[model samples]
Target: MRAVLFAFALLLAPSAPVLAQALPYHIDPGAREIVPSLAAVPSIRFLTTADFPPFNFRDDKGELVGFNVDLARALCADLAITCTVQAWPWDQAARALEDRQGDALIAGLALTPQNGALFDFSQIYLMLPGRFVTPVAAASGFEPASLDGKRVAVRRGSTHAEFIRRYLPTAGLIQFDSEIMALDALSKGEADAYFGDAMRASFWLNEHVGCCEFAGEPYFRPDLFGDGLAVAVPAGADAVRQVIDYGLARLKRSGAYDELYLRWFPVSFY
Candidate 1:
């Protein structure tokens, strides 16, 4: 009875605003997307791993939960179809998908050439943009050009470090062994700013309160950062791919995506 009441309440609640200004993902508001019929898709099996937190993982309750888990349910709900999500070990997920054990994989699988050959991918819904974090005092006058002669901390030998070497060549680059150490340098005022993956940095910002804040806009260089997160479907599953993409677009349009985004990512790295 309690479960039924809660479910009924959800049906009555309005979804979040469509294309909220703070949302990181964007879908064109003017475009008329004809969502394909999902009558043919009676149900879906979404495979993921119980490791990548906030994306997919077992919660303290030992239930499979995360942004991807909720998103998969949202996809099915949008189409009014049945769906089940299963968590597998990282090593065995690809093999299980290849064996037809699941219809889709939403485990942040990289859209690589090798994976592309093995599976079709839905449209990218999330991007791991690079960002800068500076001590609050230094954040006000921050600019990419002003980074020249500034001490910027980055993880040693990382792609982010390489990005700074190529683009912000004039900045004095200081490399640390890990993101924690780099952020620590910024907190200690040893570095003017820290540059690295925004999502990862957001976690740090959440934990270390009042020490630093994000500066400058997020940077998306897919060529350097690699392609962003997308759903992986079985190879030759064009119908499945279309349906997944359509559901994603619909979520963005209806503001359900915004609701989920805000719930999972409180810091709003973008």
Candidate 2:
């Protein structure tokens, strides 16, 4: 009987390490380890541009609403921190993080190597592949190579611009400050097609531009696009990065992230 009990104990010992690794990290709700300050520090300010809808935008009441805002709220709730949404121009918002004007940039901005050198990025939380959106009246059955000699409208400093320059260099690229402006250019017949994230392009097409249709398949340039959207923090903010990363990992694990994605973007991503 003693030999039998010893054998049973030996069998259970090997499983202990596996269980330990599966244990979730215990995070303090109201601590800087997971947020910024322990006691009532200013609410973490989220810098974003309200021009982009379905990602980040100002509602009729001047309230910030969209996927990024919802995600930020969830992260704040998990961290036991309060968040203040601030609307700034996209270029200014990027600069704000570098100038330390805000705690983080939650604008659903893509993570690129050029931006990485200026700011530290959290783990990518979502993926948005670019697509070509053109007027229905334009020649149908458009392909990537078919964009040759066509005028393409793209937002300045966007992956779409980078994509055109690299893959469709012969195409005339019209740069705009915001996605809305690009869509306007497409509507006004100033450009033959507008290239941008499929989700954003869909939103614009459905709500603003009725004559445009998505062309071909979604084009993904891993090198130019990097990963999905991540919160940008001031360089050297290791603590902030750690907290954001932990909260993001937890959100992904808790199934809350998918719910938020579905809430904002009803269309299938992949």
Candidate 3:
């Protein structure tokens, strides 16, 4: 939950934006139907870490509760199988799955070609794009060309920073040690804008009475953010992967994804 608080602290303006925020219906629109079948395994042991809030995190009761946890439960229900989500250090979770200590991994498992060789991943679920947060009156279009010559603040050495340097090189780059610092600089007019995690940027606007709003469209680089997070089934567990694919698609078509999304986000984090 510290990460959740940190997202809030980074964007401190605390006033609502003038724009009307809409439900993010564009999320995961590519889900396809899959016919589920019983896996050779009886139940799925889902490996996860509790540090990523809204995705997976421990509640005040120390219970594992969040979007990923609930989504796992929903997938299992759809598959008519039992699922046990276990938490560990984020670093160890992947090894635990590779060691065969867990049957699946579903805590923001980034899907990449290298990982694909080691594991079977379900379809994309959520993509966190880098976005620019700017003062409302200074709002710019959501495009790389729009950022040219603009002073952009970003966390030094972060994926967001790397993306800006690589893709939007013309933007005046201002590096900082922390996202909070970058955001503070943006609020104080030290920078023309802040570029970072879209969800956190959106939520930052949710809390602070808005001195600024997310500019342009959300930015994403597959090499940096991967092709979004997906459930990771053990290598060669084709049946299990198929079941996951089917279950997730069902959830998307049945509106379960939206329900779970709202339950966790509460505020618009688009």
**Model number with the top lDDT:** 1
Residue range 1-270, candidate 2, lDDT tens digits: 122222222211111111111121222333333543425433578788776665676666878777788888898787777877788987688888788899889886666678878889876666667878888866377777877898999989897899899889999999998777897899888999998766556555545435887777676566665566778988888766767777776676676766676555443333
- lDDT per residue (tens digit) for residues 107-175 in model 3: 877676787788887766777677788887777455557779989999888888888888888999999
Q: Indicate the residue-level lDDT of 210 in model 1.
A: 81
Instruction: In model 2, state the lDDT of residue 248.
Output: 75
Task: Give stretches of model 2 more than 4 Å off.
Answer: 1-43, 130-197, 200-219, 224-226
Off by over 4 Å in 3: 1-32, 39-42, 112-114, 140-146, 266-270
lDDT of all predictions, in order shown?
A: 0.80, 0.69, 0.74
- Ranking of models by TM-score: 1, 3, 2
Model 1 TM:
0.88
**Model 1 per-residue lDDT tens digits across residues 1-270:** 122222222222222342333566655443227556687678889999887776887655889877789999998998887999999888899889888899999998889899989999888888878999998877786788888999999988888999999999999999998787899899988998899988777767766768898888888889988688899999998777778888888888887987887676656678
Q: What is candidate 2's CA lDDT for residue 62?
A: 73
Cα lDDT of candidate 2 equals: 0.69
Q: Model 2: clashing residue pairs?
A: none
Worst 10 residues of 3 by lDDT: 9-18
